[model samples]
Target: MRTYQTLTVETAGRVAIVTFRRADQLNAMNRLMQGEITESFESLSGDASIGAIVVTGEGRGFMAGADIKEYAAQTGPEFDIFQAAGMRMYAAIENNRKPVIAAVNGFALGGGMELVLCCDLVIANQFAKLGLPEIKLGLIPGGGGTQRSVAKLGRSRANFLLMTGAIVPASEFVAAGLVNEIVEVDRLMPRALELAEMIAAEPAAAIEGLKALTAHAVSGDLDDGLTMERDILGELYRSEIGQQRVKEFAGRSTTKAKKGGP
Candidate 1:
């Protein structure tokens, strides 16, 4: 809802779409963009009207990566500050109360791929490419790329991507479970919004609960995750909308039963 120099935020119904506006630079994350990203997602996380969020980029890249020119100019202290801020940016998305989806339009290397790694769902354009190509710059992914990639993709695959710095096609990661779907360039935003809208139609509390539970299942202790899952379910079952939905489903089941429908 606020103006940004590096990105644009707009909403359609209950879904907010954040589009990176640095088309000429392939939407590379500069310091300004990094701060804006953190601000925007943090703002959206508190907005009750927005049920889901979609992130994408303009022109030919979802994000080419961090601006190498900017990175090269950073002093050690400046780089340290930048990295800390970057973590906050990633956390704003990954830990948001609402779901975040990456609509990867093109190249998503280094920090770009790390951005995707933070999202709950990812939909990429057919021609899109993604990798942690920071190794090519004599560096490694400072964002959660290495860890999240290994968690989402598995060790061997993450190693190939991280160690080699190879920018691979979006389809290549589908089997590894990193990508949820791929679509033509024209269909990219539409498909992303469709998924977002589908998610938005659900009870927000239930959706948030599921997001927390799934994140726990991925990285938390099993006993803790099970306890959390049960707690969340119990809470949801007692919620007004949750109770209404359950009753509606039961009513539908009764109608079907009386009509001898399976």
Candidate 2:
């Protein structure tokens, strides 16, 4: 809800569409931009009216990466401050209660790719190019890309892409399981919203529980993850919304099994 110089949030139905508004800079992640992102996700996560979120860039690029000019001259503490801000934002997206979708329209590199990886689902334009090329800059992806990418795409491919500084096409991204779907640039946002709306239709409690379950499974002990999932799912099933939906589904199944007409 707060005004952001580098970001914009628009509500469509139950979905909150968050756009990185710095197309002029190819949507680079500067300190101010990163701060806005952190604030945006934090605000959206607690808003009851918002059931889902779609993050995208304003124009040609999703995000080119970190602002190189700013990075070129940085004291050690300043560097830490920069990395911390970005990490905070990406982590917020990963742990958001509602589903988060990335509609990557164009170049998504380095920190940009890390941002995409934080999403629950990724939908990119066919022309969108994604990579983590920080090694080429004598740097590394400090925005959680190292962990997230390998978890999603396996260690070999993660190493190849990050080390070689390869820029992969959207098709390759889909094949690698990095992105869920790819479409024309004009259709990217529509597809993202479609997915978001579908997710939003489900009970919020179940959605949040599943999100936590998957994230925990990815980063925690398997036994603990499974236990938490079982407990949370049971709680969801007992909730009023979940019970109503289950009853509705049962009624439909019963009607289908019955021979008599209504």
Candidate 3:
């Protein structure tokens, strides 16, 4: 229920919508904003009422990247501390128990794009542009931009983007499997909520298991991944909620058969 200087939180049913409210500065990640983001996700994880969280920016941009002016004035320790905090925000979202969706409504560059890369799912607007333009500023993304970007988009594609600092359309991200879908500007939040709601409809145990197993699957080898998946699948199959849903589904199937439906 608490509000932060850089964020606005609104709950729609079981979904928490966290929007970047720093519109005047194009929602750039400053020290306060990054800490707020990490804290928000940490708090939301403890709220059982909120099943999922959607992160987006206010106004015409998701985030124009970190506030460049602030970055220009940082001393050695200041920059290191800020960078660590920013990484924590990104990691919090990436490793959060709840599913975090990125509803990218505008340009996401540099740190902005890195934030998107850390999210569990991304629903981007058609006109949105995403890139890691840190190289253009005589820097490189220090916040998982190299590793996470490569994990999602593969080495060659991620390499080209990072090397050239190219800002490309959302379509290219979809092609690279980075984005889940593209939507019209007006439909962005609605579609993201639709997906969030659908995910929330499932049993929490099943969803949690999936998130854990998938993370393990991606990070570990195939043999270990398969074993972990098998363990989760078996447990979920025997869970009370799972059995209840199966019974209801069976009843519906039986009724449909009696009615001569497919």
Candidate 4:
């Protein structure tokens, strides 16, 4: 387990739960938090002991956005560094071998929505609000919010929310395909943990390979994607876990046949 000024990480078995600790700011991300989170995920990606990661907010919201006050104070190199850090952090979250799930506990706007977009899965509080409201401030979502919104919600709906800076309730976004599930506030973490546990229960190599293969299929040609899938399938089929499962399946089939014959 590790602790940052803005986040806390605790591993329960194979699932690591990372909680944004700055609830007073609605877990608003600061440059420091961005750097720390990037570091955390980078570390987790290489760690064999941790199979999955869950991100959630404390108090009332997942993350309101970037720390606006801090963002407003940046200039020149500082601003460039901040924005670059955000890009790296978001990419690390999205590309990590271990699955990352966003458990949005409250408000998810602007950078928050961008962060959620990077996640492989999202489970949020039923009453949570999510959007890219950066437009109202005369700035687009510089943290990849604009691109992610379009990718996840499609162009028309993304334009409606991003252009209007509308912050709708979680249910609306769920209907639009951004969120996976919505639960009561009390159920948010439990459900997220449950989902993470399910992912962690799978063989680690297969889980990581599946994520890699799916990501490739998104942008690769069908022939290339099928080639990659076949390669991964061949690799996994020879792995210890895969072989063990195949042996168990054969034993069960033999036992069933013997019982039926006798």
Candidate 5:
């Protein structure tokens, strides 16, 4: 297990579970929290023992937003620096090689919403609410929310939400394809961990390459994206992780049993 200043990481089987602490403040992102997140994510990315990652909040909510008190106290240059750091943290998550699943347990607004958007998959609790509500504070979702919502949903819906700055229920996000699944609050972590374990069971290299390929293909130039995919896949096939997955699958009786299970 690895400990972070603002988060906790625990490993089970090949999955790394990362939980955002600061439940009292709903895990709001302050400067310290942002720094911890960035470092933790970077470390997790390079940790060979971790095959998959899960991100979740520690208590009643996933995250409310940026720490309003901290934001309010920032001056012009200070605010710019703060926002930049937060944006970089989100970008790190988006570019991570290992698949990361977000387990949204409750309110996920503003920065919280942005955090989930960076994940490869998002599983929100039924009681959870997600939104960009930054407009309400005369601000905007600065951490890829504008681009992600538009790309994931559509221009019209994204525009509506940003303009209105409304909070949408978890089911609404699911309907709009923002969230992968919605489970009861009690089941949120289990569902997320299940997903991580499933990914961990797959060929690690393939999982990493698949995530990078899909993200790059959708977010970058197609020709360059395909080339990157091909290169990564070639390297993956030659790695031990790929060989182990192939051997494990080959011995499985597909007709009688599945590749992996509960």
Candidate 6:
């Protein structure tokens, strides 16, 4: 419900959409924007009414990366502080209990692409351009772009993007597995909201558990991952909604058997 200068939050059913509003700057992440992003996601993660979140930007770009003009003005210690804040912002999205979907409407470059790397799913506009262009600026992604890119995309693809700073079409990464789907600019938001609503309709506990399990599967030891999976499964199985859904499914199965259906 709080107002933000850099972004706006609006809810549709159980899905919350956060839109970056600095259109003139391509919605670049200034220090204010970064802090607001961290605050927004962290707050939404705890909101019981919200089940999923979709992030996008207004006008021509999803995000053009950090506000370089602002970055240029920072002192050495200030820049270090900014880097630390960036980590928190990324973590707030990556570790959010509710699923976060990136609705990349336009250019997602440098730190912008890093933000996408934190989401649970990505639905990009067909014409959207994405890349890590930090190398061109004699810098590298201070966010999780270096690591998450390698994990989501293969090492070869991540290496190319990181090293060359190529801003390619969103479709280029679809086959690489970083993008879930690509749609016409007109369909981008509709498709994203459709997916978010579907996810929002699912059992919240199961969805949250699945999110944690998937994150662990990516980074934890195999044995530990398996144990975590089993624990989460057992927890879900014992939950009230889980038990009710199972009973309902079993009842329908019994009725079908009585009628000799397939």
Maximum-lDDT candidate: 6
Estimate the TM-score for candidate 2: 0.96
Model 3 lDDT vs. the true structure?
0.90
Worst 10 residues of 5 by lDDT: 253-262
Model 6 Cα shift for residue 18 (angstroms): 0.3
- The 10 consecutive residues of candidate 1 with the worst lDDT sum are 131-140
Could you tell which candidate, 1 or 3, scores higher by TM-score? Answer: 1
lDDT of 2 by residue, 1-262 (tens): 5788998999999999999998998999888888888988989999999999999998889999998888878899999888877778888899888899999999999999998989999999989999999999877799999999999999999999889999998679788777999899789999999999999988888888889888888779999998998899889889898799899999988897795645
Q: Please state the error at residue 32 of candidate 4 in Å.
A: 1.0
TM-score between candidate 4 and the true structure: 0.95
Model 1 lDDT tens row, 1-262: 6999999999999999999999999999999999999999999999999999999999999998899899999999999999999999999999999999999999998999999999999999889999898888788899898899999999999999999998899999888888999899899999999999999999999899999999989889999999998999999899898899999999999999999999
Q: Which residue pairs come into collision in candidate 4?
A: none
Better of 2 and 5 by TM-score: 2
Candidate 6 pairs with clashing backbones? none
- Candidate 3 TM-score, C-alpha based: 0.95
Each prediction's TM-score versus the true structure: 0.99, 0.96, 0.95, 0.95, 0.89, 0.99
Which residue segments of model 3 deviate by more than 4 Å? 257-260
Q: Which of the two candidates, 1 or 4, achieves a greater lDDT against the reference?
A: 1
How high is the CA lDDT of each candidate model? 0.94, 0.90, 0.90, 0.88, 0.86, 0.95
- lDDT string for model 3 (88-185, tens) is 88888888889889999999999999989888899999899999999998899988899888888989999999999999998888877889999999
Task: Flag clash pairs in model 1.
Answer: none
Better of 1 and 3 by lDDT: 1
lDDT of 6 by residue, 143-221 (tens): 9899999999889999999999999999998898889999988999999999999999999999999999899988889
